[model samples]
Target: MIAEVMGAICVLIGIPFFLTGTLGLLRLPDIYTRLHALTKADNVGLGFIILGLAIQSGSWLEVARLFLIWFLVLLASATSCHLIAQAAFEKNIKPWTKEE
Candidate 1:
């Protein structure tokens, strides 16, 4: 019972990070800011979700798989973000700046 409750709590905690990232993606002015918001929030959110699932898993093997999935996601997100940012830079896309 306690483990279930804790897992639920962890999942709940992760939800807001995902929402915040979505908000940032919609509201932020530039690609860099959006990527920053998305990658950071998603990484933390995914970590929390994986932790929750791992805790609720029936066996150590399941927990390990959860962690592996999380790691792969992290790796993929980082690589993709870097590639996108580099493409933007190569294309001469400037970050948004506040008007003076």
Candidate 2:
């Protein structure tokens, strides 16, 4: 019962992060800001979801798989975000500032 409750709580908590990231992607002005939101918030949200699933996992193998998936996603998102930002920089794209 306790594990179930915790899992549910974790899932619920993860959802808002997803929503916030979506909103940030839609509402933010620039590639860098959108990338920041998409990468950071989504990664944390995924972590929470993985943790929730791991809490309910039937065996160590399941938990390990979930964590491995999360790690892979983390690396992928970070690398992609960096590559994109570097590309933008090379192209001379400027970030949005408050004065603008």
Best by TM-score: 1
- TM-scores, each model vs. reference: 0.97, 0.96
- Looking at model 2, residue 5 earns an lDDT score of 85
Model-by-model lDDT, in order? 0.93, 0.93
Off by over 4 Å in 1: none
TM-score of 1: 0.97
- Candidate 2, residues 1-100, lDDT tens digits: the string is 8898898889889999999999999999999899999999999999999999889778999999999999999999999999999999999999988884
Q: Cα lDDT for residue 82, model 2?
A: 99
Across residues 4-100, which tens digit of lDDT does each residue of candidate 1 receive? 8899889889989999899999999999999999999989998898888887888999998999999999999999999999999999999999999
